[model samples]
Target: MTAFAEERRADRAADAEQRRIDAAAVDARRIEREKAADERASRLNEQRQTDRVRAREAQARTRAERRAARGEALTPGNVYRKGTLALVTASALGSLPAQVLHFVGISPMLLPLPLAIEGAAWVMAAGVAYADERHLPGWVRWFLRLLVLAAAGFAASINYTYGLHLPGLSAPDRQAAGIGLAAVTLLGPVLFEIRQWVTTLSADTNSPEERARRRHERKRRRQHRSIAQLADRFVSAAPFGQLDFEEAFAHAWEIETGTSTPGMTPRLHQRAARSTAALAQAQRSAVGDSTGRGLFGRLFRRQTESSPIQNPNQDESPQSITNRLGSDLQESAPETPPAGTEPPTPESADPAPAVAPEPVAGPVAEVEPVKSAEPPVLRPVAAVESGPRRATGRVPQSARTPRPTRTPDELLTEARSATADWPDEKLTAEAIRKAVRTSSANGRLLRDALKAERAERAVSEAQAA
Candidate 1:
């Protein structure tokens, strides 16, 4: 029995050992699964971080591109910055003399005088720099610079006079100080002129090539000015709904030569083509006569016609011929033939009545000559009687009188009048010449322009009268 019990105990121990091994295996599996889950989570977090970094980088790139597109990218060198520095320095230097004078003065303070002088100097310096860059004549530059310096000296004198309380010393002291400063300011410009003269006289003076280059530049400038002037005139003269190519070319020619020319350039041809296209577009927008009539008849008809209906039915045409006729009769009957002229009798009048003319029909219609009871009497019309008598076959005096030709002075005056408001610095004879030369290719266009201008002037005069 003891052996059996010992065996049973051993069996139980074995069972317990088996159970412990199973628990250890299950725990190991759970630990392995938890470690794998942690690694996966860490990898996911790392991927998210990477995506965020990429997005931020993309945003930065986009921002940089936008700034570059707007031309706001930072650049190191700038002319305005240099000019500002120079202006500041000049202002400081200019105030030195005024400051010295102010310290010597008693009673009233002279802050305004020094400030004014400094401000004037700075302004003058800026002007000088601008003028120099603009290629103003050296003599003009020097003159302007001296004027600025003189102004500064005058301000200093005023400070002394007012602040020092020495009214007697004001005029004389001012004059003396002004004279001294003027002399000093004049020194630089005078010396510069002398140096230029000496250089011009020296063996190393500007070469012939340089001189030729300068002349060419001047010519180019003149041409550009002429072209701009011509363009301006054309723009001004052009009808609101019509492009004036002929006028443009004429003005261009005048700019090219101080007078009218016979031709136009390739550029002018292009301009004319563009203008014609624009005019066509404008004309499309203009409400043409319903009958599609031309200038003389259509204009007269429009002036005479009255409004038909304010919101006519859709079924009704926008324009009605009967309505137009009624309007015309009302407006134009007063200007028609006098009632004293009797209506033609059936026997005297042609059997056929005048009808609406066909587009292809010639002006003179073939009509049968009617046999009259009384012989035809020769009678003078009012137009013939009122005007000076001319030979039966001769041209009228109005047609024979020569039109006045445009003089250079007249052309120049016209150009000046057109550009009167433009700054002198902006105006250039070269530009004018260029514009004229460019339009010299088309002679007919120039002639047409002149005719149009003359017609317009005549119309304007008549209206004024």
Candidate 2:
């Protein structure tokens, strides 16, 4: 009975464990579904906001396009004209009362005289703009301008007379009032006339760049009046659709300059070519400088010791040019072989052999051979630097990583071990450097150590004998 009870408890525990896992899985799936729904809601809200913003932008674009088609959009010129009109109106009102009173002193019928005077001046100012719009003769615009000035002058005189005799004013006050009235009367007409001039000239409509271009064009026409006239004639003669003003002018310019291109003569082209060649030659000399001081030295290189051979690319004044001889960047001659590489002759082992001259383009060097049983150790000459490519710009065969530095003793030990089996005559410093992959200085030192050892042994053998 106890065993059965324990088994039943175990079964119950297993069922509870399975139920807990199933509940956890169901809760996890519910959480995942809620997260996905929230994400969808957030994305839908963002898309709605985006669509609203785009709709607003599209509406604004449509409004702008409509305004453009009607040509009634607000402009800076409209604002300027409106502001100027307000000022002119205020000036007129300020000065017109005194002028009307001055004219009224004569007769009541003269009341309209001041208005007529003021209105006529403005009419003439407007007429100047009208003349420009109608493309009228220059004389017509000038006539209207003269009338505007005459009307403004008459109005100013009337205002001055009225202010001088103003009622309830002291002498000084009356004089100031008269001056103020006269100034206002004159300013109203002048302001109006200036505004008309601005409109007529279309000065405010043109951008600064457009104005500058027009100024340049006017100057060019003045400088080349014949070209301008010919261009104008050609433009007038050309068929309407076949040629444009600029194209016709271009043809006329070519004909007038007697060249296919405008503003270029054969002499000018030749001069340009020469200048380009000189510049290129200067570049070659600059890059050819082997010394790291190409920054300034090559540019300011003195003409001293400069070659006389005039490079076709060089300027005629050879004194001012920088030239480098032996700039062909030839490969450096093979490194001079060491003394151990010397061949064995029938004569004494240490006889000084005549050194063969290294092939070079410049001056040759000669070494005199000496005849002695035990000749002095001949120091091998360093390779000639006539090749310029030693330091000049040459494409290297391999990356120039510096070898690990070792001490003199370490270098000697390595060389001795590597070349011990080699014959004495074949044990050259160049050979040791290649065999051990060491520097020239270390190889030379090792070769000398071996030679000294050989000399000491020969002496010891003689003592033994």
Residue-level lDDT of model 1, residues 1-465, one tens digit each, is: 999999999999999999999999999999999999999999999999999999999999998899885554233323334443454455355445545565546435664655566566546655665665566888876776786667655655554444444345666675665554444433433333333344334423358877777687567547666665666677777777475644675667676755564456545655666665455435433323321222223332343354333211111222432233222222110122333455446777434434432222112222333344433332222231233322322222222222345433343334435544645454444443343331121122222223333344443454443
Summarize candidate 2's per-residue lDDT along 1-465 as a digit string, tens digits. 999999999999999999999999999999999999999999999999999999999999999899885564357677668778888999989988887887888888999999999999889988888888888999999999999999989999888988898889999999998899889988877877787787766854568888888888888789878878888888778777776766776777788776778677667766666665555445444332322223222222232125334221121122211122133223332234344454335565643335532334443234444443343343434335545422323223221211355544455567667877888899787897787765454455456556554444443454443
After superposition, candidate 2 runs with Cα above 4 Å error: 1-80, 132-142, 197-205, 237-243, 269-465
Error of 1 at 427 (Å): 60
Q: Pick the candidate with the highest lDDT.
A: 2
What's the TM for model 2? 0.40
Model 1 root mean square deviation, Cα atoms: 28.9
Top candidate when judged by TM-score against the true structure: 2
Cα lDDT over the full model 2: 0.66
